[model samples]
Target: MTVISTGVYPIDKLLNGGIEKDIITSFYGPAASGKTNIAIISSYNISRTGKKVIYIDTEGGFSFERLKQISKEDFDNVMKNILIYKPVSFLEQRKSIFLAYDYIKNNSNSIGLLVIDSISMLYRLEKGDEDVNEVNTELARQLQVFSEINRKYNIPVIVTNQVYSLLDQRDKIGIVGGDLIKYWSKCLIELKVYENGVREAILKRHRYLPEGLSIKFKIINDGIIEYKE
Candidate 1:
């Protein structure tokens, strides 16, 4: 494992000291699951610590509106070290990510973290609303590139993802593409909103932890923090 830090206590615990540098990390769950917020907060941490961060907005992942909510100091720091690239053109979004990767690689001395706000856009680029084989191939290719960047640069990579639920009357709720995802991620965390308004971060799969451990958490003020429900 490479030396990496997630800056969140519980997440750091799972990674055995945050995250290893140069590894592709993933967080997946339903909509408004707090993955994007956490990724932004994580970028803030990297910025504050005197490292450059590259945020790839594959599908317009960031907003000045959210930054406006942060404290003035944090906002200043985020602006100084962070660069956002939204590629909307002939190359497509997946290629935009690769372009950002190239930017980070060329400026390896300046980059400390690479954040792909949500990787699903990579799939959507090829499929164009059709969630079929074409989408799968592009998505897989992007993940492979993600892994390469992780190993080569030793920079921590965080990718957020949207989930598709399988309609089932049975007890289980099916999540699409996750079975393939587990192969590339070192840790997995899922966010689910319960029927009673309590959101639980289910430790569905972690490489070194128990199967069912969970934490009650919330996203507040554009930041990701933990709390007891």
Candidate 2:
């Protein structure tokens, strides 16, 4: 299976070379934990290889300025290859996935990665009005569609998730989608911000990687970089 590098050395090492193709890799963390940076860097790196990337932004967090900072002279070319979708609501997000899947089906040879920046944002917003079971079922169905796309097209899917602190379990954080995400994701990574602005990525679960393995990295103006010291 082909793997796409995240464009960060230590992160790629933690992922056992790189993110495996045809699987869903999830990153969950609080604000400023480097989730978006990883997604952007990965998209930029994959696009650099002359392949197209499908980026779905649920939180309005897609930053062209940041992309320009990372891609430098290749900004325009990279943007050309990336087909971005900004879904304003939960329904739109689902529709966007279907549209992306269809696009990939037609252009499988050219598409390399599928990125959903903050997959759970819209879900969280709509959760209060919907039944819990109904929400979960819909979420499962959406993820299943993504899995099918990955398995059939051999495209790597990267999704970012929000984290919430549990009152009883102060030290252990819970991901927004709860157990469903944990069960469906092929690889799960947890990001944490430490003292002195240090950022760390913990490889919580993977098909091949040993649990509890981690790596340290920093988000700079250019992109994600391994810690110097």
- Alpha-carbon error at 1 in model 2, in Å? 3.6
lDDT of 2 by residue, 89-159 (tens): 88899899999989988999999899999889999988988888898888998899889988998898999
Candidate 1 regions with alpha-carbon error over 4 angstroms: 13-16, 88-91, 128-131, 169-176, 195-197
RMSD in angstroms between candidate 2 and the native structure over all alpha carbons: 1.0
Identify the candidate with maximal lDDT: 2
Q: What TM-score do all the candidates reach, one by one?
A: 0.83, 0.97
lDDT by residue (tens digit), candidate 1, 88-199: 6324667777887788778887888888777665554545666577677666776787788788777778877777656665444544456556777766777676653455
Q: For candidate 1, what is the lDDT?
A: 0.69
Clashing pairs in 2: none
